[model samples]
Target: MRGTLGIATVVLSSLMVGCGSNAELKTFTITGERIIVKMETQDRSSGVAENSSEDQLVANINAADEQEISVVITRNEGSTEEVTIASGTFTDDKIVLEGSVKQWPTPIDIYVSRGNEEPMKLHTALLDSETNPNFVLLDFESSDSEDRLILSGVSRMLGDDSDKFTISGDLSSIHDQNLSLAVAEVRITSENPKSISGLSVTELLLDDSKFLIEGIAGEPFLVAIGVSTFDYAYWGHVIVIVEPGAQIEISPSATSSSFVPGSFASPLLAKSQIDESLHRKVIESWQNSKKYLAKMDEYARAIEKAAQPITLNSDVLAVWDPYYVFKELQAIEFASLTSIAQSLEDPMASLLAMEIGALNWMEYSRKLENWYTLASVFEEDIVSRRVIPQQEALEKQLDVVTNAKTIVKGHSAPDFTLANLAGDEIALYDVLANNELVLLNFWASWCVPCIDKLPKLRELHSEYRNEGFEIVFVSIDDAYEDWKKGSEKHEVPGVNVGDLHGFLAETPVAYGVQSIPTEFLLNPSGTILDRDVTPEELESLLVDRFGDIPGSE
Candidate 1:
């Protein structure tokens, strides 16, 4: 079940070479034997992995450009455009790379390409100081030839740096010796994984359950506990400010999902206080809001059974009534999170505070400006440079969705055509021409809320069909098969059609469909009369127009 093929001979050496007048420059050298391995061969002809000359190996660093010609790190789905700190031609059977940087902790990416095609990433490392020369190895196993060749390796900051500060912690409380401890520079964006450097808990226990962290010190950092079985789910992180010769202690627990510092309590304790306060306040608010929501639901049912309109207490309208109580709870959390982030002394800590605030792109569009403003200030520090750019990109996406969602009532509805189940193109204008009003409903098959509203929509459609009312169901399903199945399964009663591109499709984007089950009532002239009309509101409006329900007394 398990086997090992020696693809490369890794060398161990430490040589500090000088580069020009850069006194802060640090040198890195990587030497290893390179061999090609094929996972799936129809004929099991070869006993060992094959070596081919067609495969090309290259290395890159996140530093100033050393070569005029660009060398981009091509990942599976996206490419990371980085400055090449070092460059060289690879020999047939070995990979030898030497690079120098003005900073000690720099990022390195190794890739392999074939026949002038895009380079595929093989490994990534956050190279830093180490006492002993670190060895690099990659292992992959697969029975299927069509499957992708998985690349696996571990990189760490293992060496000694005299100028660095140390943060020591005790793992005696944690009995799970199989866990892995990760210490990463706190980042605000998705690139946080790239900053991670890990150490084995079993190995740390060997040193008396005491873990030592020595890195580009005198800066704030975060530590997280990752379980081996879970592939290191983020329990939580504690902000530690490294002081020269200071012993900062951290207790990381998997069961409680807590990572707090015993020493240096200023930032961690403050964050804890903020989180605890927010939690208490949210619970209190949700309890009060639940009573009102329950009463309102009961009132809605009463009105539905009576098949008539009823006026409720006016006081209920003003109490957490501007929007859903859930929205109010989210608003409270984000406001408190912003306050906590602003109170932190370290930019990195502040960045991490905002990162874990659970802000979304489309839903929290209004907060994008403020987040961008905060990230701009954080990017002033060199340590935050690794993640700020990506954060800015995420915020930019929020801005785009925000702008798109701003399509309000009174605006002309954007018209578009799509294919239905019969492979016939149906235009919005054609539907508008026949019906006095059209409920243009944007939904997806995977959306539960979208499916939940279908029965009521069908009822309303049946009731109002004779009164020149029509419903057009637009599905933003990425797959045609899924769309066809969902449409047929739901027995969607409307002019059902799909663009099959999800939210990114033209019709969805034109109509600003950020969330599913978004509805717009368009008049025969194609002007949006209303948006986000609830099922109850739709019934009331139809009643007002048609006098009463046909079957109701």
Candidate 2:
């Protein structure tokens, strides 16, 4: 089933005067600069199809009035604190906002409220920062026939600054055209529909197999196509990146597997094809890599089974040998995906590279040079542009690897002062002074894996406490109650400290902890012996150094 091709032409227009009282006008003009927001609403209560005459559509828009609408502009610096710089009401068929905020390196949030309905918010980044004032015109129309809202917008700089760029495009779907009747509604959502902050619709228009969406140059957004049938509604998403002043066309296709059944489907999995051949190759490569992962998991499970009977120090060599097999499987998967990624194009290649990089970091985190090599791979070609978010995520992973490099075997451990459950400050050096060896374990109550390893940790601590072995369990739980509960439930021996800030805590960042259950083994001299050792490995090491479990001998 192929979606009908509908062209959505977005033409830049001059700002139009609004017909409203001056008292009703809320402006955000800063330094004689303003952003004009124009909304056009159409009444589709007559059960007329979207193919209605352009003149009729205009008449419907002009006939609409006194729609209660509100606008809010906010600055987002990718942090928790977001500043609302400007806000206004959309009375008299328009809203004009002005602000002195000159440049926005990060994207700003634009929210629109209509009547008592939930407001709609979209993000817009500054494409041409040199321009003094910018304008974004949002055109909204209600489709009473389909029970959905149609939204589109175009943004450009106000003056004759030629540095401005515009991105205009039409979206074509690969679903059945008859499914259009099943579309209950449509709206502009975030790039990830699962993160759809406001509303989820039952159906969206697919009659023409084409929908129009506009974005600022060099920004990405999501257009959700909803299909409601058999009393179930599913959303198919498409992610589009608008280039500077380019009319790049996008063809979005959805298969049975493309949708998440009852919920939202991610654009990443949505079989979008700008270049058919490249997309097919990407799909093939992705499937092949997934098969490798399945095999890896199979091997991992077998290794886990083989290692289950490791109780005696003598059994350590044989049972722990499966880790070599696990590493081999990981290597094979990494190589396979890396090869596929190298053979693919930008977005696909970048995605595969990201997967490979993650695996590499997890398996070979102690090898800093390997991380550098992976980072270099991510910096190449269009892949770099396509994987900005992924790249940003890699920073923490890279930091872990970099920190591992500095605190590798034989290096002196970094000292930290953390508060215990009793609110008393305990220094790492102070703990190391009395203990022959210290195992610093970073964990959280929320992490199931971390909690699962508590029994083994407690057993080891009980058996080795007299032999000068200390286990420092640092809780990264955000809530104090959860931390205290987990500590008491687990009966974690030795020192228990809570970092409460979780990953944002300074100690975890200093120790380069990307994930929980990270354990660091320090020797008597406070030198790092090993890091990220598994529970079994820790037990094996203790047994090897202490000769045997007290009762086992």
Candidate 3:
């Protein structure tokens, strides 16, 4: 028997006539064996006081047919709690729940179940205020054979002034038995479970559980399911663009054996289309990449070690310096892997190349071009359509990279005047005129790394003051008082100025200061010599440009 599925969109009118007015009572009637409710709030307030005596919001679900049904509500806070209403006598069929929300944008999940059957889960986000609430209710029924599932729902937003969103779709083609496929049940076993415990699987691309193989026309869906530790520090994942009704199994090697320094390879151990030879090549490529990554990591550790005393103050520099090293090695890895992918007749080559490109892009935005190229190749050779929705996303990333490149080496530094603690205005060009070198240090008191680097900056100022070298501290603190207190407490030398606007400040925005503790070294002519260099790197550059100060080394 074929199943029928229908969806209805409905909007509920607002109970409040005007802003800050009393809310009128609202009621909803639900009639179905299985129900799913989704609610969204536009501008709900979260500061409402919670008083049990006061009436805030009330939701009631009554079983009109006097049938036994169970209701479970799950809250989506950091720690989730499931409240279940068991099926009972006639009076118990009607479930009434009332509560005041202390937090805005709280998502609640409701699961309704019948005798020994799977429960239907409904999702909704609640706002603290009862002024206006948006809700969507989905009702579903299933056949005895479980071959088909029928769905219908009403979406509604209360209040005439409410913003509405209308969504329409047909599930008629999806209900066809020929289009339905059993999902590939993936089982993973770690080679060394003791080393990496607490494993869980997360779907990287697809958000829905019901995998639609047919009746949906587009690129073949490339589902990337990641098997990682609970903390997600380690990596174990599989990528597959499977055919309809395909099943596969994967067993990941231990983290020590499988982890490439800068990449996550697919665990395509067993699949319908993947033969033993292709699978072996994929594993060999992954293992070979680890060797190169180890070399890169070794070089990085050496550089990190050479820049001694790896304290929190210099951690950013230590971390960033190695990335430059990794990028260089990654280029070589990309070339080698791309060659292997091109030589191989199987689809594994494209998959390997995609993984290489993805890892490169994560480290450097400039690699977006390379990733786009690989994605295009994957689309042409493997899927023949866009397997991932990254074309538009890559375009946006390219824009960000272009914007950030504005402040790179050889670019003229953007000038701005900000007020010092004495309320005196200091301009960037003016400082550059007076000193042979100026380091613009963007910092904040709340930033731990920024605070940690203060003493070292002070030391650098003392060591180079005589050589016409100066450090300018640009505080992005929201309040002048906090900036002043931090400045005076740390005794930060040189010209100390506060933007007060912090990230939104024009100077930092122009400089592309996305994160704190960003430092830029400028020559006397205001040309950006280098950016985000560690104190050790800055000192090395300074010493290389000018002889050591009169101090005996």
- For model 3, the superposed segments whose C-alpha errors exceed 4 Å read 1-218, 221-225, 231-246, 254-411, 414-518, 523-525, 529-553
Candidate 3 residue-wise lDDT, 272-363, digit = tens: 33344332354335434666546544553544343354466655454445456545655655665566545435444454444435344354
Q: Tell me how candidate 1 scores on lDDT.
A: 0.49
Q: What is the lDDT of candidate 3?
A: 0.46
RMSD each, Å: 17.9, 17.6, 20.0
Error of 1 at 9 (Å): 44
Model 3 deviation from native, Cα RMSD in Å: 20.0
Question: What C-alpha lDDT does candidate 2 achieve relative to the native structure?
Answer: 0.48
What is residue 127's positional error in candidate 2, in angstroms?
A: 39
Model 2, range 432-510, lDDT digits (tens) per residue? 9999889999999879788888888888888988888899888989989989987887787889998897774767777
Give the lDDT ranking, best first.
Answer: 1, 2, 3
* Candidates sorted by TM-score, best first: 2, 1, 3
**How do all models score by TM-score?**
0.35, 0.35, 0.31
The local lDDT score (0 to 100) that residue 146 gets in candidate 2 is 15
Candidate 3, clashing residue pairs? 10-155, 10-156, 11-156, 11-157, 12-157, 12-158, 13-158, 13-159, 14-158, 14-159
Per-candidate Cα lDDT values, in order, are 0.49, 0.48, 0.46
